[model samples]
Target: MNATDRTPADLLGSALARDPAHPLVTFYDDATGERVELSVATFANWVAKTANLLQDDLGAEPGDRLALLLPAHWQTAVWLLACSATGVVADVGGDAARADLVVAGPDALDAARPCGGERVALALRPLGGRFPQPPEGFLDYAVEVPGQGDRFAPYAPVDPDAAALAVPAGSAGGPEELSGARVVERARADAAARGLAPGARVLSTLGYGDWAGLSAGLYAPLAAGASVVLCRNSAALAPEELARRVASEQVTHTAA
Candidate 1:
């Protein structure tokens, strides 16, 4: 099907059905010093799991904002895909203070609590030690939300023109909302126009929170049913390290 004919659900579903074993995401874990890979099927499951958590547990009704402050991790991609399927407005925030739900590591979680807002802490054991004890009345993400189920049923189809995400307005002091489906459609068209194949591997050094990051790094590849190798610490690392990772990962396309 053409890009316009597919929703995020349809795209992901097709990818999973066509090549469930294909690697959808690959990331380098600094702590483990190993590259972690998640296949299309595994990614679909995590997206479903995240959808269940947002819709069933969080009571995040359709059109409700579900902000995230996650770093560039596999879970971040899962949450984005989940939001699309569940009809939740997934807002990617630049900082914890701006987000409705912050899926952060331990240090970011600690720093964000003082902002005094509702947030969800996505616990990654590899990110750090066990979850730190929250102060009085703070929500512990793992404790509050039940584990996601095995199967996920998507919500009703969304209007392509509807607002899908909210981004920070540059120097404007407020958030700017954008159409999710439109962005996906455009990106898909662009990728196809560039002759990108379904399973092509892409190297992206964009930060996870920004527009380019979300688009080129995550959505673009997924929309095209391709693989993405994301470098979260691109700015801090040397050029050689970046080159090594790209070559090692066998990246076919790059948005560097």
Candidate 2:
């Protein structure tokens, strides 16, 4: 475990410095036959750009809530880190009416409109393609992110004790909120529980609607300094096809 890493952003920074060329995340969509891999450096770049978009353009400050209306896609993972870097609390599947900002995919646009704050939409297309027809009353993320700076420096240091992530109270007792430090701690715990080590590759087929899925699909591998094969729509894949992916991606561990 990394004693110095107190937050998700810290873990990402450590990973970026340890090995920038190593693959950090490999994403797939079984139905679309799409696969994309991102190195640590590349993923960091995306995080930086998205952070800038949140901070500079949207004027989002620390403690502000962002209702994230997306699924378990690679871009959603990027948004998670970006929120941590900026000290913005990401409310996964949260109530848009209570948010200061909103980011949604094409399918979630209808659910995002209640937020009066600045709204952003992601196409979630292959290779990060822009929406062919822009949605009204929203900024297109793919079109805006390229113009952002490659490096990010938050105006203020993030507070580890402050809330970072809030999951909707689905079938649970109440909403679950975690501080930055707790997020890192849980990720590390999950990573160790799954027997991940540095450079280990993990395959996960979990959605991002709750803490369990987030831990397995993204944060755990990242905290372990390992990599992930993040699969979207895994239910569509045949059993043989799933086996093929495990062999092809060289997955050493699995969390599902």
Candidate 3:
């Protein structure tokens, strides 16, 4: 892969071709006692299905905004890449009302109701199960995604210069947009600044709300050809427990 290739989809493709069976994303939910590990191939599979759902099922075209009302989990990582692959702009934590599609978790149901476009809900259960009783206005992601094609092809090729992310300002500013190339550029720089060596396994307990967090938690690792061990409900863990996880999971770098 060329060093200048900056699209998230291109980063993933490089990773898959370099090491298909290597761990890509390892997720842990301390509150739920859930742990899932996805290799590069497995991660790519999930991204493909979700991308197909976005492109084909939801009619998401290039530049379409999809509000990702989700937390830091394995599937959320999948959705980010899926959006890149399908040329959709992932608006993480953005308002659903302004989006073309909304993919929400249980906590965001009420907030996502006003979204007039397509809505998909993730139960976030162990093994990615569907809700016992489906939410009234949202399609269950687990139920719908499995039926999508395993392979994904965007309606049109993604332009590296096109907007790929919409990040709301944390302080006193308007929302910031990042092009596909910029996303990759930022990730690589952030990874190097954080001293993430090549193929490092990084553990992070951060939300994907801003550029820094998103870069550290997902894109940076991909840019470095590293893997991520994403931990949610991190408040439930003691300092010693976190250290134990770092050792057990073979985490070489950490972004707290």
* Whole-model lDDT per candidate: 0.69, 0.93, 0.90
Residues 1-256 of candidate 2 have per-residue lDDT tens digits of 3689988999999999889999999999876888999999999999999999999999999999999999999999999999999999999998888999999999999999999999999999999999998899999999999999999999999999999999866775656899999999989988888889998999999899998889888899999989999999889778898888899999998767
What global local distance difference test value does model 2 have? 0.93
lDDT winner, 2 or 3: 2
Worst 10 residues of 1 by lDDT: 127-136
Model 2 is weakest, by summed lDDT over 10 consecutive residues, at 167-176
On a 0 to 1 TM-score scale, where does candidate 1 land against the true structure?
Answer: 0.82
TM-score of each candidate structure, all chains considered together: 0.82, 0.98, 0.97
Judging by lDDT against the true structure, name the best candidate. 2
What digit string (tens of lDDT, one per residue) describes model 3 on residues 1-256?
A: 3496779999999998899999989999999899999999999999999999888888889999999999988999999999999889999898889988999999999989889999999999999999999999999999999988878887689998999998878788767999999989988888888888667999999888777778878999999899999999898799999999999999998888
Candidate 1: C-alpha RMSD after superposition = 3.3
Q: Candidate 3 — which residues are off by over 4 angstroms?
A: none
The alpha-carbon lDDT assigned to residue 249 of candidate 1 equals 85
Q: What lDDT would candidate 1 get against the real structure?
A: 0.69
Task: Show how many residue pairs clash in every candidate, following the order shown.
Answer: 0, 0, 0
Query: Per-residue error at 130 for model 1, in Å?
Result: 5.2
As a whole number from 0 to 100, the lDDT of residue 124 in candidate 3 is: 95
